[model samples]
Target: MVTRREVRLSPSNLNYEDRRCDRCFAEAANGESWPQGPFPGIFAKLDSQQRRYFTDRSTSDIDPTLPPGTLHNGGRVQSAPHAIGGVDFTIRGSMDALLRFDDGSVGVVDFKSSTASPQLGDAYRPQLAAYQWALSRPASDDPEEVSVAGLLVFAPESMVDTEQGRAYLVSTTWIP
Candidate 1:
C-alpha cells in the first residue's frame, strides 16, 4: 500500500505546474513528482545584483509612485496548510522584494527578467496571491498586513562596455 504526503506548493509551480495541465497538478497534489529543469543562471545573477542595489533603499527608488517605503529582499514566507478549492496545501516561497510602508503595511514586489512588461495575469496572479497569503498568514512570523502587490520587470535593452566588464542596460518597468 502507498500513502500520499502533503505537497508544499510553490508560487513558481502555481504559474506552470497548475496552469499547464490539470492532471499534472492533481498528480503533484497527491505526492507524485516530476523532474524540473534547472533554473537559468542569468536570472540568478540579476536577482543577486538587484537585491544588493535595493538593499537599504526605498521603494520610491524602484517606482516614483511607490509608498517611499523601506526595501527588503530575500524574505522567505510559508503558510500553514490550508484548503483551496477543497485541496489542502501550503504556500512556501521567497519574496523577491518586500517593502514596509510608513503606515505599517507591507508591499509585495516580484521581479521578472524579461524584455517585455510581464502582466499579473492568470499565470502570475496566483503566485502573487500565494505570497500575499503566506505573508499575511505565515506559519511562524507574526502576521503582516499586505497593502500592495506588483511586479518590477527588467528588460535588457543594450550592452555597454564598462570599466569592469560588459553590463546590460536594463530598463525597469513598474506594474502596480
Candidate 2:
C-alpha cells in the first residue's frame, strides 16, 4: 500500500542508483578532501600520444623511464554484458592499454604518470577491477572466452637534483 506521491518522491527502482558502488562513493568522498589528483594534468598531456600509440596498438619508441621490457602493443577494449542469472548486470569499462605476448594471452595495461605516490587502496581496486570484470565478460554477440589479466603502469616524473645536478627517476607496476 503506497501512495503515488511516495513512489514519485522515492524512486528506489532506478537501476543507476540501485547499482551505485559503495567503494566509489566512499572514494569520491575521500577525493573531495584531497587537494589534487594522482598526477594533475598528466592524463591530458598524454592524450594525443595515447590515442595515437596505445589506441592504435602501434609500437612506439620505448620510454627511457619505463622499465626494461619490450613494449609489444597497447590498446583499449570495451566490454558489454549479456545476462546475469536473475538480474541483468551490465558493466562498461575501458582499458588504457592491452599488451599481448608472443606465446599468447593479453595483459591489460593502464598507464599513469604521476608526481605523487600511487594509492593501491580499495578505492583504486574497484576501478581497475571493473575494467578486468568487464573485460572478462563475453562480448554481446561472441560467447567465447575473454582475458582477465592486466597491469598498471605508473611512470613517475623525472626530477633533477639541484645539489647533485643529476637526474633521478622512479616507476612502478602492479598486476592483479
Candidate 3:
C-alpha cells in the first residue's frame, strides 16, 4: 500500500527547522500541526496602519521614506501542489504589500515593526525570496514579468511620551 500526504509550506517556516519538521511529519502521518503564539497588540495595530498607508498614498500620514511606486495589498500567492523528493507540498504566502515601479516592474515590500532597529538577517531572506518567486510567476507560469526578486523592509522609529502615549518618531529605515 502507498500512503500519500499533503503538506502546506509558508514563508515563515523557511528558517524554523523544528517547526517545519514537525509540520511535515504530522502531515505525513495524517495529522496536522500549526504554529502557536500570542499575537502582540502593538504589532497588530502597526500592521493595520501599514496596510492602510500602502493602499492610500495620497493620505497625509503616508511615510515619505517609502519608495515611490504604486502599492498593492491583501493578496496571497500560492504554488500548485507538487512533490519535493516524493513528499507532496504546497507553498503559499500572504504579501504584505506589492510595489509597481514606474519602469513597469514589481517589487515586494514587507512591513516590520520593532522597538529595536530592524535588520534583514538571514532568517528573513527565505521569506522575501519566496514572495519574490511567487509574484514572478503570478498570472501565468511565464518568467517575463518578474523583474526583481528582492524585498524592501520598512521599520519606523518610535518614542515614548507620558501624555500622548507611544509615538512613532519621524525617522524610518527601508532595508533593501
Candidate 4:
C-alpha cells in the first residue's frame, strides 16, 4: 500500500509556475528544490506599499462599484491538508488584500501592476481558488466564508515629474 505524504504549496505555484510547465509542477509537488528567477525589487516594494495603503480602507477605495466593505486580512492564510488524487496537500499564501463586507461576508483581492492590458479570469483562477480554499479550510485559524475574489489591476496612465521625483499615475480596475 502507498503511504500518502503531505505537501505544502504556495498559491503562485498554481499560477505562473504550474501553468508554465508540468515537469516543474511535478517537481514542486514532490518537494524538489528549484530556483526562481529574479524579480525586480521595485514591484515588490510597490506591492507592499499598496497593501499598506489599502489596509482598513473601504472596498470602494479599490473601485467605486464594489459594495461597502472594509479591507483586512492582509496577511498569510494556510489551510488544512486536502486530499487531491489520493495525495494530501496544504495551501499557504500571503493575501494581497482581504475585504469584509458590511454584511460580514469576506472577499479576496490580488493586486497587479501592469503596463499592458490586464488579462482577467483564466490566468489567475487557480491562484485565487487556492486562497479561497485555504481560507475556507484553515489549518489552525477559524474558516472564513469567502464570498468573492477578484483582481485589482493598476495600469499606468500618465507620468509626471515633481520636486519629490517622477511619479506615475495609475488607473485601478476591479475584475470580479
Q: Count of backbone clashes for each model?
A: 0, 1, 0, 0
Q: How close is candidate 4 to the true structure, as a TM-score?
A: 0.90
Instruction: Please give the CA lDDT of all the candidate structures.
Output: 0.80, 0.43, 0.58, 0.83
Tell me the spans in candidate 4 whose CA falls farther than 4 Å from its real position. 16-18, 115-118
TM-score of 3: 0.67
In model 2, state the lDDT of residue 60: 26
Give a tens-digit lDDT track for model 3, residues 28-115. 3444554558877887787787787657442112344444557667378876666766677666778777766566676666666532
The number of the candidate with the highest TM-score is 4
Clashing pairs in model 4?
A: none
Number of clashing residue pairs, candidate 3: 0
Best by lDDT: 4
lDDT comparing candidate 4 with the true structure: 0.83
| Residue-wise C-alpha lDDT for candidate 1, range 1-51, written one tens digit per residue | 544345688886777435678888867767788777898998798899988
Candidate 2 colliding pairs: 108-150
